[model samples]
Target: MSETSDSRAQRLAAESLAAGSPTAWFETLYDAAGRGAAEIPWDRGAPHPLLAEWLVQHAGEAAGADRTAVVPGTGPGHDAELLAALHFRTTAFDVSPTAIERVRAAHPDSAVDYRVADLFALPPQWRGAFDLVVEVMTVQSMPRTVRAAATAAIRSLVAPRGVLLVIGGVLPADPDPDYGPPWRLTHAEIEAFAADDLALEALDHGPDGLRYRAEFRRSRLLADTTSAIERTPC
Candidate 1:
């Protein structure tokens, strides 16, 4: 039998990890999918349910005239499209140029500003720039070596009083070293988003107990000990 998409993703991730470029395989995955050699395992063709519900609950506060939101690792652009439909000035990005190109092609007249950007080296103006950020499954995709950097990048996306929402599978305290391209997040890892000036406002477990939804907010009033990183420019 030919290689399945899941197996292909795993093989690519393993190869990329060994090469010291953990995220490099994402481009290859999208490229193969475009050529019909593979499918993207995570392209569910709908907004993630947990993220959709959160947006519904906050609908009144969610839409705004000049407010902006960002979605990282927006593979097929579902969540980003939904945010745009709800009237947010949304920017969505993926490191893979093929993925970015595909999402753009998928929505030629879309309001979302789709870009190819690496989360690790985002533009300096992005620091504390967005009024809201919805990150789903992105951080859990990173290896442990980049966990701090990943959380910091996510944290820096929110402006003061802005919100950061996360949704991901819950991993046990310790897991097998070879577990995933999505290396499911530990509770401590999720809590790291609150380490800087961001406050953990809500944390809920999905009914199945396998998933987590977390909400964080940066206080409009700066904390006395807040570092420049927390004050956040680049």
Candidate 2:
């Protein structure tokens, strides 16, 4: 016997709530998403509002640059599409083959290139290739031990004069040691995480100053002029 629409919906919702971590949920989604699932709840359907707003505000500045944007952990490609629409040559990746397949099918003609790449195992050819590195709720999904490695991988993607934008959510309190794949990063912790060669350009914590947007710019490249200037030995 076939199930009713409402019954199927109810069953899926129940399964999701019981899934616990978002990562586990993604695994479930990968299996169920098929070749082309129209509506995944985590999709958010449209472009990310914060990113869209920034693109609109910076349209003029971005238009003149030849920049490549990399979206790590791009599940269903909403954010990648948004970046491409804004004129950035964007590429997005996820470890899940199913998720990558869905994204590629959805935007077949788009400039966005959806590839399957593990966060840490990015192709060497892509190293230092992006002018913009985006981490949208991706890093927090990892265990604490690998967080540093994840941060390092993101940093490596940015060119000397590039930027990194990380959008992460917050938990009610400190995340329970038992509950995760959606770790909450404190503002201080984030600052420390990206402290070495990147500096915060703009950080908005919003009303509560926790769940937020953090933008980091790679330290300015030391130009060849430094050697030229040193010849004078003043």
Candidate 3:
């Protein structure tokens, strides 16, 4: 008996699964999408505008002069580069192996450490090692069912007395609900979550008013806490 093409394909798919691959279809999609070729849709071809704006505003103002910054779902590593340039020790990660490899390739001399790591299943060693956690459009890219978990994981990465910088788009007053991949984060929603364990330091206009730039500080209290309300706060 000889194996047919169909049988071979099945075998390969089964092997990939047995090897703990992401999804069987991932390779095919990446192949057609030119995964490592650069110019990915999520890539802005430079550091995100919101990230740049925040760095400019607080590059030297953060209380702790020496702290580690981590960028989850770091695509082309532009934001990580910006953090490193600002003198913070930086680590950037992406779930996609191709994306992580691309980051390293695109920035061979970058001071940041680029790694392949899932946002939800971060390595236990990194549980609370970062003083700054930067999340840019990552939660939106995930399934809605996992958004809360995604938010928790991101929050968990922040060290005590650290900050979380979130840059995302706004939802319509009455959104269609499913029209997302750019999931809108309502202001109320942000406050609700951040209030649970973090303090809202700033929720200002990002590069553009349409997109928001939010900065949160981890609460000092073991119990629930909230930051001072600020309409024009930092």
Each model's lDDT comes to: 0.85, 0.67, 0.68
**TM-score for all models, in order of appearance:** 0.91, 0.75, 0.77
How do these models rank on TM-score, best leading?
1, 3, 2
lDDT of 3 by residue, 161-219 (tens): 78888877767678865444445676675664474457776677633456777778876
Candidate 1 residue 133 Cα shift, in angstroms, is 0.7
Worst 10 residues of 2 by lDDT: 225-234
- Mind giving the per-residue lDDT tens digits that candidate 2 earns over 1-234? 665433443355345546543234454556665734423544677766666655666676455247789999898898888788767888899877888887888888888888888877889988878888878877776656566787787778886777788777765564674355455565565664355566665665555544577667777522321121111100
Model 3 misplacement above 4 A: 1-39, 61-65, 206-208, 220-234
Worst 10 residues of 1 by lDDT: 225-234
Query: Model 1: what TM-score?
Result: 0.91
